[model samples]
Target: MADTFAAIATPLGEGGVGIVRVSGPGSLNIMKVVFKECPDKVEPRHVYYGHALDASGNVIDEMICIYMRAPHTFTGEDVVEFQAHGSNVSLRLIVMSAISAGARIADPGEFTKLAFLNGKLDLSQAEAVIDLIKARSEKPLSIASDQLNGSLGQEIVAIRNNIKDVLAQMAVNIDFPDEDIEQVSCDEFITELKRQNDRLQSLIKSSEFGKIAREGIKIALVGRTNVGKSSLLNGLLGENRAIVTDIPGTTRDTIEESSSIGGYPIVVVDTAGIRDTDDVIEQIGIERSKNEIEEADLVVMVADGSTELAAEDFEIAEHVANKKVMLVINKEDLGMTAAQSDIDKLKSIIGCDTGDIVYTSVKTVKGIGKVRDAIERNLARGFIKSDGGNIVTNERHKDALVRAKAALVHGIELLEMREPLEVAEIEVHDSFQILGEIIGETASEEILDTVFSKFCLGK
Candidate 1:
């Protein structure tokens, strides 16, 4: 018998209502003790209005409670939920009352863990529940929801079934050596292994875009002082998020803000201008700016279009030479003094011939849309389309796929070398188990603990 567990499902704060959840065989009995006006036989899946009483039979709060019977509940157990006024004291007392009525407080993620153990959800879908909760944007939320609907699991199961068919062919060859059957030749074996490997490679490729969608892209604005970096940041965000002024080092520290562009989340960072500065604080800010450039997914090099290119501008370009860079020539409204020739000169100086160069005026907001489009185009290039396809967004899934691919490659090599069938079978079986780990069929206890530990209590 499973132990009964209770927890406050909602966030702990003032709200219109709060929910206290209990799940296990003893849930109904606990409800009978704490709730008044309870019928001797309560109907499942129905809400009953009642007063929650303490251990001493004193009314604690008027509440609405619902009871869900076994096999249909989230944890596949008898479940009860108390909806009471959103008061910390009241919710705590209710939880205490349930505990006194023979329920124990649930551990973090215990509810979802129970659902996984009882076969209500696979490990992938259970993991998706947490992703859905922590998603910061629509794309991530949509991806997580799709995974929860079993897209990724279905794909993995299909791949496993195909591998199983190949294994069965090998088994038949081993068991019926003298029988006249269509034997799996070395070429056919390699072909089948390569086919499944290609599918794994496709899924691995999708992970890159899935990661970007789950975690927004980070873009750093790098340039010399007083080049409208702050202005550009404000313009991109469509609001004044950074201080803009004529002072060279007004922004001595990096300012980060998030916004959505073309349905993709992006973290825009405005860094201090890269130039010679004697001030200690400005030096630290410049160092931090260099670090941000190193870590940024994309670097937008802002240049002043109103003035001729200076030595400092060339120096800044050289710093971000090897990074994924987009050159932005700001202040175009003031009559562009820096022309295409200047851009070519800077590109040559930076040793980067390929980059998106957009002319914009933060003051007039001209050509800002073009700059944004360049960013979206660069980020979305070669990214897999998210249209109800199985996309692996989790690092664990990627690692497992990598191992599985390696095993398949090894198996194919063995077949090509004319090694004994048993040796090749070993590698193929290893690949099968590796793939199973992704959907939790072969996952160990430690992996499950590590995964569910990231979830919050009562998930």
Candidate 2:
């Protein structure tokens, strides 16, 4: 049976050029039969200019072909790349021609899947390829790139190796009790297990911050009607994405936009101002704003600095007490009627301690940077250290770390109870397996399939 597959690598659209990538055992053979070049035989890793021909010996198109032999190719198999005319119809015809000459269409992620199966890449490294491709922010890209380069994979392997070594020592101790096999004492086992457990727990703690970094934080702008929520959003975005008007309830729905703050991606939401209203559209908007406020990771309560805090302000304060609030006292350009004393009184009434409120004039673009800094501080709480360092970014790694940590704790408990070396051995074995899964040392076919399925075709 033919072990070759082909697909158009580029996205289907008008482009400068298009490419058809083929891989497998028959790649070079099929290229020779269908391509009129190189004396009817193609050498591996050589790019050749050629004319693609059909079964009737008629020229279909002029193209460029490159052959990559097994062991050095992406899929660890023979590979060919065809640069043909930039047309969907032409590319499809080329693929069909290769199929007729004995190649099958590659399934989604099949090329990378083959690479994983062939030992070219581990499960985590394979996953990093997709993450790198889909990364929307610089931080995510950096994290994914590090993972692809095997930083995360290396760490996992190291942890798994440590656990496996401990298990092997325990196995020797259990089988050859008389032999001086450097048997691990109960106290030593407990101490070592706790050490690894703490390390694993630290990694697991980073998962939340990693998620926020991957998926931007959601910030909801909420306040009483006519409080300049839209103005603040536009000021932060540096564009008039949200409509601004003097009339209350002008913004009848939520407006969403993305921006980078302190190297973190943040999705800012301009929600309709909350207030009592009878208008049908206004009521609907008010409801959405409530939901947005409830779901927000950060809430910016925009209050009019020109007036004293009202009942509505207190209501907002009560609603946002549970959320991370950055009290924005906007319209400082309006000649502040509320002085520091008034702001302090408002803070007291809102039940917020000092330092949560920010004085700003959106019209003049003041204090916007501080707001951004505050949002980043909240989002980056537990993930990064003071000097800025690497943190765990994969959910699988985080889960494995958690499981390993738990197993280590169990091992520690067994050691404290002075149980048989075999008892501690079982818990140590469990921890070893958990760490192994992280590095693919003990991962099953189902896990591998699920991880690689996230990749795009021709990866």
Top model number, TM-score? 1
Stretches of candidate 1 exceeding 4 Å from the true structure: 347-355, 363-370, 382-388
The regions of model 2 sitting more than 4 angstroms off are: 38-46, 50-62, 306-309, 346-357, 363-374, 377-390
Q: lDDT for model 1, please.
A: 0.87
Report the C-alpha displacement of residue 121, candidate 1, in angstroms: 1.4
User: In the order shown, what is each candidate's alpha-carbon RMSD?
Assistant: 2.4, 2.8
- Model 2 scores worst on lDDT over the 10 consecutive residues at 381-390
* Candidate 2 structure quality by residue, lDDT tens digits, 1-459: 437998888788777678889999998877876687745555777778888876566677889989898889888999888888888877878887888888888888888888877888877788888878877777878788888888777877766667776777777777998986667765765666676677677677767767877777789998888888888898789999987889988999989899877666778999988878889998999888888988888888888888776678778777777777777888776767756775666566555545667777777655677666655665566233333434676788788888888888888788788888788788788888878777677898888878877766666
Worst 10 residues of 1 by lDDT: 380-389
lDDT of each: 0.87, 0.78
lDDT of 1 at 194: 94
Model 2 CA RMSD to the hidden true structure, in angstroms: 2.8
